[model samples]
Target: MAIILAITNSKGGVGKTTTCANLGAALSAAGKAVLLVDNDPQGDLTKVMRSDPKSLKYTLANLMNAVLDDTEPELFVNRAVIEGAGIHYIPANSKLAGVSSRLVALQMSSRYRGGETGGTPCELVMARVLELFQSQYDYILIDCGHSMDLLTINALAAAHQAIVPVQAHYLAMEDMADTLEVIQTIRQGINPKLAVGGILLTMYQGRTNLCRGIQDEIQADYGNAFTVFSSPIDFSIRVAEHPIGAASIFAYEPNNPAAKAYSAVAQEVLSYGQK
Candidate 1:
C-alpha cells in the first residue's frame, strides 16, 4: 500500500504546491514510486510537473466523477503522466472548480435525503478514486488548494498522512492551528488512520532574525503536539526558477540549498516508515 500524503495548508502563498512537487521529486530521486495529485483547481502542481492542465484529455476531476458514476477507474490509472522528473502524476484544471461545487451540492442533497441517495459522501469522493491506484505507487502526494472546502475534505479523507507546509513567517505560523484542526477533524470522523506527517517550514532564511524567531516559536508551540522537521527549506530564487516539466530541484540544480533541505526532509519522512 502507498503512503498517501496530502500537502495542505488553508493559507495560500505558503509554498504548499512547491513543497508537494519538490518533496515528491525528492522521494522519487530516492527510488520511491511517487504519484502527485493536483487537487487544486489552479493546477499549479500540474503546471510545475510540465503539463498543460487545460489541454490534458483526462484529469483528477474526470477520475473522481467516474468513481461517483460507477465507471471503472482503472482506465484512468495508466494515464498518470510519467514526467521526465521520474514522478508520475494526475493533473487537474479549472474543471475541478465545478467538481468542488458539485461536491457541495451532493453534500447538501445528502443531508436533505438523509444520505440515502448519494453513492459516496462528498468527503469520500477522492478517497474512493484514489483507492483504485493506491497500491501502484510508494507515495501519492496530493496538493490541496488554499481552502477547507469539500475538495480539501476529500483529500484529507483519502490521505494516510498530511504534510502541512507553512512559510517561515510569524503571520504564516499563526495559521498552523487552523490547518491542524482540519486534520484532527478528519481523523476523528472520516479517516481514523490519518496522521500528521510533520509541519514543514518553508521559505526559511536562516540568517534573518524574524525567520529564525518564528521557526523557534513554531518548534516551541508544535514540537510536542506534532513533528516539526529539523530541516527547513531555504528561501531561494532557484526554487522559483524551475521551469515547467523540468526534472525536480535535484535535477534542476542539485546543489541548491532548497534542494538539499528537501532531501533532508524526505529522509525524515522516510524514517516514519521505519518507526
Candidate 2:
C-alpha cells in the first residue's frame, strides 16, 4: 500500500503546492515511485509538473464524474494520469469547482433513497479513487486547495498523513490553528488513521528577526504536538522561479539551499512513515 500524504495549508501563499512539487521530485529522485495529485482548482501543481491545464484532456473533475456515474475505475484512472518529471499525476482545473456540489448531491440522494451500504461517502471520493493506484506507487502526494472545503476534506479523508507547509509569518501561524482544527475534526469523524506527518516551515530567512521569532513561537506551541521539521526551507528565488519554468527545484537548481532542505524533509518523511 502507498503512503498517501496531503500537503496542505488553509492559508494561501504558504508554499503548499511548491512543497508538493519539490518534495515529490525529491522523493522520485530517491527512487520512490511517486504520484502527485493536484487537488486544487488553480492547477498550480499540475503546471509545476509541466502539464498545462488548458491542454489536459482529462483531470480530477473527470475522475470524480466517473466515480459518481459508476464508470469503471481503471478507465478514468488511466485517462486522467499524466507522467512527467519522474512522477505521475492526476491534474485538476477550474472545472473541479463543481465536484463539491456533485458530491453533496450524491450524499443527499443516497440518504433520501437509502442507497446501498457499500456506497462511498462524499468525503471518501478521493480515497476510493486512489485505492485503484495504491499498488503502483510508493508515495501519493496530494496538493490540496487552500480551504477546508469539500475538496480539501476529500484529500484529508484519503490521506494517511498530512504535511502542513507553513510560511514563517504571524498570519500563517494564526491560520495554522484553523487548519489543525479541521484536521482533528476529520480524524475524529472521517479518517481515524490519519496523522500529521510534520509541520514544515517554509520561506524562512535566518537573518530576519521576525522569521526567527515566528519559528520560535511555532516550535514552542506545536513542538510537543507535532514534529516540526529540523531543516526549514529557506527563502530562495530559485524555488520561486522553478514553477514558472515548469520544473521542480531539484531539477532546476539541485544545489539550492531550498532544494537540499526539501530533500532532507523527504528523507525524514520516509523514515517517519516507516515507524
Q: For candidate 1, what is the total of clashing residue pairs?
A: 1
For TM-score, the strongest prediction is 1
TM-scores vs. true structure, each candidate? 0.96, 0.94
What C-alpha lDDT do the candidate models reach, one value each? Answer: 0.88, 0.88
**lDDT agreement of model 2 with the native:** 0.88
Per-residue lDDT of candidate 1, residues 1-275 (tens digit): 99999999999999898999899989998999999999999999888888878898888888888777778877877675445457788899998998998888888888899877647778899998888877788999999999999999999999988999989888886678899998999999989999999999999999999999998998888899889999999999889777644746786688999999999999999999898
Q: How well is each residue in 1-275 modelled by candidate 2, as lDDT tens digits? A: 89999998899999999999889988999999999999998899888877789888799888877776777767878889998858899999888888878877877777887864355777888988899889999999999988888889999999999999999989888889899999999999999999899999999999999999988898899999998999999998879786455568877678899999999999999897467
Report clash pairs, candidate 2: none
Candidate 2 error regions (>4 Å): 107-118, 243-246
Model 1 poorest ten-residue lDDT run: 77-86
Weakest lDDT window of 10 consecutive positions for candidate 2: 113-122
